[model samples]
Target: MQSIKLRIGINHCLTDNNDLRYNGETLSDGFVQHTLWKYANWIPVCLEIETDHIHQTLGCQSEHINDLSKKYLDGFILTSNSPRHDSFRPKVGLSKGGTSASNDMGVFARSLSLKYPALPIEENDRLHDPLIRENFLERIFTSKRWNIAFSNSFTPHALIQFHSSHKFLFMSHSVSLYQEMGRLVARSGLLTLTELKDRYVVLMSSSLKQMATPNKHTNVMQHIMGFLKGLIDADEKKEIVETIDQYRTGQVPWIVPITLLNLHLRKNSAADWVLNQTYLNPYPAELMLRNIV
Candidate 1:
């Protein structure tokens, strides 16, 4: 269990009482409101509603970047406001003339990335998916652990050991990149701690992006299947193929195959590092996050 509740920044447009959304309808996802809310401390952020006292009182604020630093938030959720109604007279800017870029969520997200280069950031819509949400939840906890425990000070071998322990997760996205990262970790040989941190951050960000989108996530799962082919027997390979087929046909959730892989890996005596990963079982088993499929 987490000793501290994660502080996450959410887009204010999703919660404000005022009719700020372009669709003039409530934007609600029950999982976020009920499940995630129970586990996290949410801080609302809105640049457009900077002056709305009512919204401010509700916890929405304009200066989120500074607040993020001060509070040491664990993650961020960027919800889209779409285009405001014509009556609202929305601000326009791609380069400051109320351009698209100025009003874009990417602008704010990019700023967050630049300032807190290792923060776990995700768009709101992606969190609607159970798989993506579970992955994000794991990342939030893992990142907080890294920041609080190992970021500032560590022994000479701590960073390398940490990287090696997380190699299973690093394999979740690109096999080539994962291999290259392992090579870099080996070659660095106890120096370049800052560079290793930056690489780890990039790995987290890239893996999240890949798994959040359906097509990309499909590719990711396929890659995982490919990687496991040589390691598992013919029977296990067939089972994996069937599980992936079910996933593609909407018969099962995505976590089924991943859990399967984890199970297989755990049986290998040489794979003790896989046993050390708590992220695989991040939430209580009763939550059925992995069993939903």
Candidate 2:
């Protein structure tokens, strides 16, 4: 089956190729690479423009904040100099040449998290890192899966099976989340499917966020490969070690080892269950997301 195309909400400036700073110029075409532009559907959101227009009608920023909550967005990638908290609340910048926090895109990075706790949000700055980009794409895909799964004829067994398939990812990325999922799975009989799914999605989003952070990078590769250490031959083992070293040195993308491991796993019938996992190959292989070095 093919992966669903995600609807990604992006900052207006990033989309329009404009820079919102006082004397800033236009953004380069390479701001967002062609691979991402071609892969996902981007919806530009000028929260500031909407804010400026609605400010007079609503008469208060708090009401505008409430209004922003109503927009339908799967995930948001905010550009730099974008308003933090979606409000130019503080006079951090001036119209002419002075600085403004509202105009500072970096300040607005985490605003979406506070506003929508379950929403997957990222900054354009962080996407330059392949690992972070991979994590962001993974989260949106999982978010869409969660949305579709819950909005359909979901059953308790399905939730359990879903948890089972994705449990390896949590185990590899976040042990605490792996344990939390285990505990939640145990309560499947007692809890409603909706309740369980809600809790599971929240934890899943949290786990993706946790793994995306820099601190978890070293352990993620180690954890996944650790499982395959005994299953592969000496040559495969050597390749994995070299791949991991290359990844550590930034000589290759983080996915090189994963792609290599996936290839190795595919050859062994004993690896069918692990190979069948959704998170292990979440995105379409056609995207070539894993193929690049």
Candidate 3:
């Protein structure tokens, strides 16, 4: 029932639509921006810090990047637009006011990249490319998924539920890994909880590397259709099949079929299991990540 909240440190990622207020009806304080959502529960310590807090401590203005480590955050986002941040590499900094300066975004970026090479440290410009943005979202969301689902509970039952919810999404990534994950979850009692969790993490990391292709997505859509058997009328089934076929043939994006599935479930109130699958609402529909993927 908990939403994945990402603690992204954005220097200047905001545009005209920065603050789309959520009426707090959900659970916590958060806002939606374009297609992105920022939750208060994202980072462990965002609640403790004041909204007006400048994050400047002592002489280091680039200190916010380090905040991830201190607060046990899953990841960080450095979406800056300045030339200095854009032109910076791991060790290189601008020449003027040399010595890496006191409070330069470039220096901060360099530090973040060099120190946390494995973390999701991205810039806004590079993310303009569709492919790059897709990859970034995958990595960030996958990492977030691990933290949210498995981080709290490592029992066999918990693992099984986690795998069940992400079943279709995993199939879209790699059918092979999807099968392997099911096997691991099924055999969870055979191994220690820690071992199972470790193996699942390793597989999850590798499984999502390859982008979901049309064929794989078609496989999931087909599988979900099986769940709706006898529930949909003949014409409704044909319409759904046609939409899936369109997505498979690349005539339309996955959004079309996905939206259709959501509507069907909403109107008919299918099985609870079907409705609970994260595949139907992996992230926010506003994100449109699937639309581009």
TM-score of each: 0.64, 0.70, 0.66
Off by over 4 Å in 2: 1-3, 18-33, 50-72, 84-115, 212-253, 285-293
Superposition TM-score, candidate 1 onto the true structure: 0.64
Cα shift from native, residue 231, model 2 (Å): 6.9
lDDT of 3 by residue, 221-241 (tens): 889888778888999999999
Give the C-alpha miss distance for residue 25 in model 2, angstroms.
Answer: 5.1
lDDT of 1 by residue, 59-137 (tens): 3323556667877778877664433111111246567565465243344555676687667766667667667776777
- Flag clash pairs in model 3: none
As a whole number from 0 to 100, the lDDT of residue 219 in candidate 1 is: 57
Per-residue error (Å), model 2, residue 221: 6.3
Number of colliding residue pairs in model 1: 8
List candidate 1 stretches off by more than 4 Å.
1-4, 12-29, 44-63, 82-103, 130-135, 189-191, 212-251, 257-271, 282-293
Best by TM-score: 2
Clash number for each model: 8, 10, 0
For candidate 2, the per-residue lDDT at 195 reads: 91
